[model samples]
Target chain A: MHEHQEPTPETFSTPVLSTTTATATAVAAEAAVPGAMLATPANESTTAQSLSTASQEPRQGEPTAQSNEIQLTDEQILTQMQAIKDEEANAHPLVDNSVDLTELEKEYENGSQAFKNKIKNLSDTHDRMRRSRGDGNCFYRAIAFAWFERVMLAKTKPELYTHAIKAMEESKDLLLAAEFEPLAFEDFYAVTLETLESVPTSTPEALLTAFQTDEISNSIVMHFRLVASAYLKTHQEDYAPFLEFGQTMDEYCSMHVEAMGRESEEMMLIALTKAMHIGIEVAYLSGNQSADEVNFLPFSPDTEPYMPPLVLLYRPGHYDILYRKSHCLEGVV
Target chain B: MAKPMFARRLSKELKDLAMNPPAGVDIIDANDFKVWKLGLAGAPGTLYEGEKFQLEFNFGPNYPLESPQVLFVGDNVPIHPHIYSNGHICLDVLYNHWSPVQTVASICLSLQSMLSSCTSKERPPDNANYIKTARANPKHTAWAFHDDTV
Candidate 1:
């Protein structure tokens, strides 16, 4: 048993200086080690400065090395690393539905021609983008927002709302069968039901505003994620082959698929789409696409022509809700 | 104030636990939903057979999303390799491996089994040193749980 010690007097006094130096060193180390900072830009200087101010004031301590060469305990280093991770995690909003597409175009102006073309393809289809926070829950958030919008649209149609509610209620058996304790997921399910219940009385604008509210939106997303996890677990045989590496189905879901803020992959999408009996069209705008073409991948494509599909726009690591003009009007009719 | 969702879920869990109390586990005090005190009877066939232990559970606003802070409390803390003198339990299910799907009942059973599997009656090797510096809340400590055999 390795006993963890309190920060010694020498290490306690200059936590700010020590943590700053440590962060800078860690960033420098990442840059030094090839394949460590690949694809991710090294935000060293900004991180160092932010970390210096963000560090808590040190407790009393004995005189130690000069501030420039302070030493940090393993615990202090871990805390600092967690703080940096938290800072990065909260860098974006839970859902920003008013992002301008031109901003994306401006970002890739000087980038590769292929990327530029992909941007043009995206611009042709989407007038704006809704940015989900990069906290690794983007897929769930995007789907939740889209689902709420659909519910709100179907409010005038009693049969549609009833069908959705029936689907939601039936999902409880699946979750229970998958060994999920009702105590752990009931509140999420309740909140989701409550949100759907409110749709009939609320205007679409009001519904949109409520969806933007963090607490309500996140709960709905969490509920969806849980349902998706249950679906994956119950139908493990269908998804096990898709698991990369040698990880077992339970391991994959617990670590990635079910865990909050763990980014979604193709397997999660497939499970969710199939479980909800909802068709999803993901418009992929990637640099790899043909010069003037975009790729639209259908997930759980609808066999019934009358069912309105849930569409999402996918760019490299993020997902956003997408609206097709005709589909939006169809709900009104 | 606790988040509405957390409070609601905890209430449901409290009701469920009341209806279906696990063997060898009793809810001692649950006046406050955020904090619960549970009494556990050592499972038969365990080294700690015939002993009773108290466990404290403190839930954050995140509740199911984040794991609750659980620690052994009271005078009769179990002396086992994974249980520290200060009452902090070194269980992976209480930490990194925690999932929202786990409930208080499941956790109690896991701890019960953990105690049942122990063969030694001695405290952890570094128990004295760790207790001296351990934080009031075990969640604050960065626990490195390497032993899983027990």
Candidate 2:
């Protein structure tokens, strides 16, 4: 959390000397976070400061330096501060496994009854919320984090890893059958397979660290997106009714499902979970009147004897990993 | 350390294209996986019949996630209403409509059909002005693909 905190002006002074070193340090700092990498420092203010300082040099006919300083209105300053805060939030890891649910309650203290009730319900079933960044990719990131964590915890059961690998490998055929070019999707699929296969050999600490790496994590998420897209395309007839705003299945998938960084919707979750043969329980915590008692909506319900269900906490526009007390001890006890 | 993912996918595509290429399409240069050159022949029974053109594809490190930079090059560029004199094509599939499922072969087939469906042979209306101010890469241009009736 300290790494995600906004860096003070003094912290910026040291890194400002070398742009290359600043970038390297930023990457390292992000890796230090729990699940995701730290966000890169915003270079806007630094650039603005340098330019202003350069322009402040006294000229023969120019007025005194006091007149050249720009003054920002209160509204402008507030907007700028809000923008910085948003950037800091975005830079936080895609998933934080130790976030307490009380923070969420605090966020809604001044809100309506629906929000308070939602939080109360969430607190009953979930003790902590593993936050995912609010970027459009939160759903994929959250799911991937859960999958990787499961693999690390279930290392003794090699069959789980093997099954995940088989599922990923089989997804290639689905994408190809859906008329996706093998060349376009093979790279993403291959990276996903590599990550899945490595889970058995790597230490749990190493596996966790790998997910924090942007290149590896993003590739895995991209592969999941492809799987979801292929599932929707193959079952277009079954899911077409859910398409909103008169968008054809192809148009919807192209615009939202297939495109990188696009958020997932209900149809996507259903199709993706069904395709992977894994069940997901999403506890919706929205402020809508309809949201009550942390409704646990199941995606792809399963009846397997040993299949561990993936649980997630869903707010209005974002998703986070969730852990139940009993399930968390299955690996150790 | 090495970019195995990009290299592997591009090589596989090159192999597939070589083994079975679509009609009138040929791979010109594929030694460098990051950049490729392709040759396309105008479809028969169309305005561009008997014409030939070359296309350049430059892929960034983030290759499938990001759309490739594609454009026509060489002297015999096609003259279509949606094509600029500078060899920029105004097709939606190449830009905003791009999906990760699309491959080099698919794009080539698309350009072939774009040529086949043309009723006339002419540059876009603002060809000269666009060519003058356009950046080196067509991907940078904010093209408005309003006219799909071409």
Candidate 3:
């Protein structure tokens, strides 16, 4: 019943941004993992003067305990921190196999009673859930992985795979109709189509490997981002009203959808689903809901959805793949 | 894997820049995909008209996905409210607002417009301090883009 539904923002992408959620995320990230993150731009109002002055503040409390770390420039430190965050997320593959729901329960162990109750209730029907990395693109990555997995299992239901390919193929036209240059977007489109075509013949391990690589995984993310942006741009009448005041749909899509590390919002989900003719069921696991109940929100395409909606577990600013009890594709996974 | 993407994208951009180059943009060097140098002409009717500025574009493997490291290069950097003496630009699109859809041509055009709209001939107020303390790479600088009506 609480009104706030936006995802909790995560680590700063590069330079620290001015958004309140981003600032909170940066502070939490610095505290959670100690390193050069200590030197991050503390706020959006940091003038060029403060940057130089901050450097002279005598960086203390950062003696490298793990290794004989030599000196590193602030740029190098930021780069290393980025690598560490990547490694932590890479601890799980771009997509991971069904983990016992207890594993998720462990994350909130000292955290929340309401979340604990929902997880306890969730395990009854959803015995196992797969996960995607917590990188900002997790929502798009999860939806892509989940839909592709379903299409792979639909060997008997050839229509699903065929439909997915059609949707992907038509998305290029959407980008073009929205006036996105072919030269700018063609590479992402080609990589995405190649990955989708490989899913059917590829084993689950092979699929996981493909998604693990940066080129393939990020290209898919980029393509979907473009598709969502294109969908919003071409169908402005339907979505323009939803944008914030003084912000045009083009600006919203540019900032939120096209940028790689930017998080996706509800409008993005609706646009992506409607654009690709896919349905999505997002299980909102929140502390605000009744202790024992999880809310499922549906995002459906304008027409009849061709396949069962791909399900995702949403836990504030992050998305991970979830498996229903009846799903029988363990061998593939 | 990303190298090929950079090659194809950069090559196409080079071809576009060569064939139908935007007004006042000219390529000085682009033999390789990694680094390119292009000349940006300050637009007519601006403070820098008839003045030529050299721009250096360093492309990482992440090229269109990640933005290129672009700055004023060579001897003559433009004197403007957003341009620092060390060549770092305080433009938002170059950093926080980067989108893959933007091209090298588009960037040059944006810079051209940025220069064309200049109302005064001056450097950023922080130019002296910034050039003294900033790193070689502009991306490393935590730029605050607050002013737009320069």
- What's the TM-score of each model vs. the native? 0.76, 0.74, 0.82
Which lDDT value does model 1 have at A185?
A: 78
Q: Is the docking of candidate 1 incorrect, acceptable, medium or high quality?
A: acceptable
Candidate 1 colliding pairs, count? 0
Which ten contiguous residues of candidate 3 chain A have the minimum total lDDT? A1-10
Task: Identify the leading candidate in terms of TM-score.
Answer: 3
* Alpha-carbon shift of residue A263 in model 2 (angstroms): 1.8
- Tell me the deviation in Å of residue A332 in model 1: 7.1
Runs of candidate 1 with Cα error greater than 4 angstroms are A1-93, A109-111, A154-159, A244-248, A285-292, A301-306, A329-333, B1-3, B122-134, B144-147
lDDT of 2 by residue, B2-66 (tens): 66556666777788899989888998887897789999998888887788899999886556665
Ranking by DockQ: 3, 1, 2
**lDDT (10s digit) by residue, model 3, range A227-302:** 9999999888988877778888878887778977666777788888999998888786655544477777788899
> What TM-score would candidate 1 get against the native?
0.76
Clashing pairs in 2: A30-A38
lDDT of 3 at B140: 54
- Model 2 agreement with the true structure over A174-239: per-residue lDDT tens digits: 888788766777677776788787877777667656666656776778888888888888998888
DockQ in order: 0.33, 0.16, 0.39
Ranking by lDDT: 3, 1, 2
